[model samples]
Target: MKCHRCGREIPEGDNYMHLGETLCEDCYLDIRMAVKACDPWAVHSATRFREGSGHKGTEGLTDLQKEIYELVKGKGKVRKEEVIENLNLSEQEMQRQLATLRHCELIKGRKEGDKVYLILYR
Candidate 1:
């Protein structure tokens, strides 16, 4: 079976069902686990972790997170939809990754006119 969300092939017994959709392990876990960027404790924890580990910029981010950062950095700014399309990620996945990056103070959003774009935090 193929995951309904990510379209990855699911091995014989590894598929999961959610709201009538079949999902792979990764997609299932991603949906089950979510982190909010606006949580003060999350921000504090990320800040403390980065400072204590001496990891600057994108050093401590996941490979995908780093890629997202680089994509934004390279472009100066990009719409959320553009990043989601470029990375081929679900909206939820993009939100989670962007949350982590935002918590780490690596990326942020900017409003230009009526549009919001993701850009490096400075």
Candidate 2:
């Protein structure tokens, strides 16, 4: 069977049905935890954790996470699409990574005129 969300071919009995739509595991998870770029609680918690941990500036991040941070840091500000293309990440993958980075207080989204840009936090 083919997944309704991503069009990937799923073996029988391995597909997830969500809201009457068939989805692969990855797509289902992505839909379940939709990205929230402007979550104040996430920011506050991340800040508190960072202060308590004493690890500064991407010291305790995964390799991929650090790469994302550096990309945003070097560019100063970048569009979401640019990150996706540059990192060769799927939309869902990018969202998941971005959410984690945001929760860690490493990156944030900013609106300038008609576009949203990703920039390093602080």
The number of the candidate with the highest TM-score is: 2
Candidate 1 lDDT, 29-118, residue by residue in tens: 765553432345665676677788885556546788988998998999999999999999999789879867776678999999999999
User: What's model 1's lDDT at 101?
Assistant: 79
TM per candidate comes to: 0.57, 0.59
| Total clashes in model 2, counting residue pairs 3 or more apart in sequence or in different chains | 0
Model 2 misplaced regions, further than 4 Å: 1-24, 27-55
For candidate 2, lDDT tens digit of each residue in 51-122?
A: 998845565456777888889989999999998888898887888888777766789999999999999998
Error of 1 at 113 (Å): 1.2
- In model 2, state the lDDT of residue 8: 95
Top candidate when judged by lDDT against the true structure: 1
